[model samples]
Target: MKNIYTLFICLFLASFTNAQDKFLTKNGTITFFSKSPMENIEAENNQVLSIVATKTGQMAISILMKSFMFEKALMQEHFNENYVESDTYPKATFKGRILSFDKITATESATKVKGELTIHGKTKEIVIEAQAKRTDDAIVMSGSFFIDLADFGIEIPSVVKNNIAKKIEVSFNFDHKPYKK
Candidate 1:
């Protein structure tokens, strides 16, 4: 009877250790900026879902297109109905790995990430330079990258093309806690 009890305790401990290697959060934030000579546009979304596997350096992020908020309702409507077609493609996602995973320690470190970004039903490979810091309870990751609007099948109207930049700057920040279950 004692031997069986010991075995159960060991198994439980092992499972708990493995759970510490993964982190997740459902309220990450992602922001985008478009700056041109004519105008500057910006939007932010705080309903981003993200996960990081520390043991393998794998990461995934998902954000609802409609979650992005703009200062102007007209701009938001145009962005959803025409630019992004949010009804058809409701989400954007990124799946990739952090390079040199083993070197990431508790201190803040600079790293490179190679991943595939999917937006508007199109996928493209992208590399981003990011900063990662392991806190006492969470791993905070932040980065910015530029993406061409045309590459994602996002077309701007000719009349307003000058108002939008050809390339958009996107930045993200995620504080991931150990995922339970």
Candidate 2:
């Protein structure tokens, strides 16, 4: 029927338009490093989920705390059970908007992204400087930032006080392809 054909056409167009307005990636990378007088520690997680809304320059990211792998198995175990308490706080999240986002092109540009970062059940407002690029098919973002452990109520025990740094350096990268349903 003519009505059925029109309805199908409308649905197709809607999806097509939506694909252009949003980008997503399931395997983004997030790494963190801590330096102390005793030693340096690092961990990486590749199972990060991120989304970008091209229309509003808004972005959201979700990272599983347990997904982070450390160089040593004991360190990883301590991180989940002693430090981050992964059982109680399983995920870290970020929701933010990109400033001067419309200026990004196929060429990488320095952009400011402001957002709320939630970790260990605590939230903090943060502004990060990131390199961002946008093309017809994809959006790429990479950046490094520092976070204070005390801000999130993650207390370091005195037994290993010299083993961890107060501030941790975090790096992230996400290449998002156009989202399609």
TM of each candidate vs. truth? 0.88, 0.90
Q: What is the lDDT, from 0 to 100, of the residue 49 in candidate 1?
A: 79
Candidate 1 C-alpha lDDT tens digits along 1-181: 3353344334433543576777877789999999999879999999887777777788877778998999999989989999999999988888889999778777889999899999999999999999998754888889899999999999988999899999999999988998765
Off by over 4 Å in 1: 1-18
lDDT of each: 0.84, 0.88
- Separately for all candidates shown, the number of backbone clashes (residues 3 or more apart, or on different chains) is 0, 0
User: Following a full C-alpha superposition, what root-mean-square deviation does model 2 have from the true structure?
Assistant: 7.8
Decoy 2 TM-score against native: 0.90
- Which residue pairs overlap in candidate 1's backbone? none
Give the winner by TM-score: 2
Q: For candidate 1, what is the lDDT?
A: 0.84
